[model samples]
Each structure stands twice: as C-alpha cells, then as structure tokens.
Target: MSPIPTGRLFRTGTGSDLVLSRTFRASAEDVWASLTETERTARWFGPWEGDAAPGRTVRVQMAFEEGTPWCDLRIEACDPPRRLALSMIDESGAWHLELLLAEADGSTELRLVQHLTTEDGLGETGSGWEYYLDLLVASREGGPRPDFDDYHPAMKAYFEELPARAETPGHVR
Candidate 1:
C-alpha cells in the first residue's frame, strides 16, 4: 500500500484550505454510505446521532481520540453520493470541512478539504486528517486500523513544509 498522500494548500478570500484525497475501488454510493451512515462511520472515523439535515446539528464521538470526546457538528450541505459539507466548533476553534466524491471506472475518489482560519496548526491538523482518512480506508477494505503514531510527529515536517499558496490578480500562483 502507498504511504499517506500529501495535501495541497489553497488561499481563498475567506481563509485557506488544506485538501487531501484518497481513492477507493468502490462505487460512489458505497463510499458515500461509509461517510454518512452512523454504523459505517463508527467503523472508521466515529459515530454521529441527531436529526441529520442541512443546517441541523449532530453530536459526533471522536472515538479515536484520547478521551473520545463528543463534539457538535453542523451539517452545511448533504448531496448524497457526491458531496457533503459540515462544520464543528470545539476547544480547537471552528473548523469547516467538505468531502467531495467523484467516481469513474467503478472507483471513487474522496477529497477532503478543511478550511483553515490560519496555517498555524497545519502540522497537527494535517496529520490528524491523514490518520482518520486512512482509518476510513482500512475500515472499508476490512483491514486493521493503523497506529496514529505512524502519522503524527513523523509526518509533521512534510505538512509543515507545504508551500503557502498566493493568488495573483486573476489566478492562483
């Protein structure tokens, strides 16, 4: 298997975003269920419960975290089998995230983008996403969950070194 993939950073008028993606040899519908279904998600990221709809809030358990803390997550958008956008606020501050799915030739690619208020915590944030996303892959593939240690401090420098994206008058450079 390949190592964790690297993400590209982009600067927008509101803030910057760090985008990472993983490809799965499954249909978009299957991948979408793995992302949105409570039981499916529990096998990977965590489980969530509450009225699920655009603008509604749900409580999600960070199962892999030290204390398995529960956090409130708001659903911003939910276009099944294609895209889902959500946000959360915790001790770390507000986080806006989007998951986009594209399928081709019987495979689906999941692109996860986290809107950043600042580039300050890219190292920690990027590593956390990498680990969780990989866990999603393992869960879908029926493989064992990977150790977080393999992604953190070890992958810190790589994330820290990602270039800052600057936009020109008409386009991003």
Candidate 2:
C-alpha cells in the first residue's frame, strides 16, 4: 500500500477558512467547566492566573522551547456550558476565538473556530490553537497533558512534521 497523506498543521496564510477545528469525545459540561473555571483551565490550557469572565481582561502566559508569549486576553463573550469567545493579540495580529460546546450522543462535542484579522503574517494566525485545543480535549476527558506550550516558533516545527505524515482514509494525520 502507498503511504497515507496528512495536512500541514501550521500552513501559515493558508485556507480561505482560517479555522482549525477539533471535535473530541467529552461532555459539554465537562469541557465547559474546564474552560470557564480558571483553576481547571490552568491544569491544561495555560497559566492559572485569574478568572475567565466576560468583559474581563485576563493575562495568559505561554512559553515554548524558545520563549514565552505574554498576551492580554479579553473575554468577548460567554454562555454557560455552551459557548465562550475570546479576543487576544500577538506580534502577528489580532485573533478571535469562539469555542462552542454541542451535544452529541451521550457525550458532547467541543468545536473551536478562530478568526485571525489581517495583521499576523497571514490571516492564518495562532498556530498554537490546534495544539492547545487538543490539550483542552485531554483535560476535559481526564487524560494526560500536552507537550510544548506557546506554539509561535514550535508551530513551524509542527507545520513541517504534518505534511510528510500519512493520512487516514477520511482523516488528517
């Protein structure tokens, strides 16, 4: 058989839909709790600095193999156990992320869609979202944590690794 195919994880400035979405196995309440609760969020997403309230400005510190990126996180919107929206900035540009939780079977489906404004290199900003969102999946499902925070420079490495891998019949490797 021939080798499978895989899409590049961090193809900067790619895709008309600058969105990297993931639907993992979990419950809406479980996922929602982890995201809204700062203490729980710290265990997975980032630092446990403060609360993630709507209209609240929170500071999230993420570091990678290279350095840390300190960003001003603004909670643009919130809906209990359902949806949470955030707006943040980086060296590239402004990023808008809306995480939604939908009921699927006995479990819940968590989807994260991001909108990168014209500023960060290309509209395909926040290379870390895909990785970090996976982290969220693990955290909500009572699984292990993810490696390598702060996807800035690391994203380049991940981007390189993805395209060369094999892909499943209907899934990306």
TM-score per candidate: 0.92, 0.64
lDDT of 1 at 164: 46
- Candidate 2 structure lDDT: 0.58
Scored by TM-score, the top model is 1
Model 1 pairs whose backbones collide: none
Q: CA lDDT of 12 in candidate 1?
A: 72
Model 2 poorest 10 in a row by lDDT: 1-10
Q: Give the alpha-carbon lDDT of every model.
A: 0.86, 0.58
At residue 33, what lDDT does model 1 achieve? 97
Clashing pairs in 2: 4-167, 5-167, 92-120
lDDT of 2 at 123: 13
Task: Estimate, for each residue in 1-173, the C-alpha lDDT of model 2 and write its tens digit.
Answer: 21111112222333222345556556678768777766676766656465667999888766321375667889999987888888887775667777777778766766665543332343123355655665666676777655544444546544444434423232211
Per-candidate Cα RMSD to the true structure, in Å, reads 2.7, 7.1
Model 2 ranges with Cα > 4 A deviation: 1-17, 48-51, 63-66, 119-127, 141-173
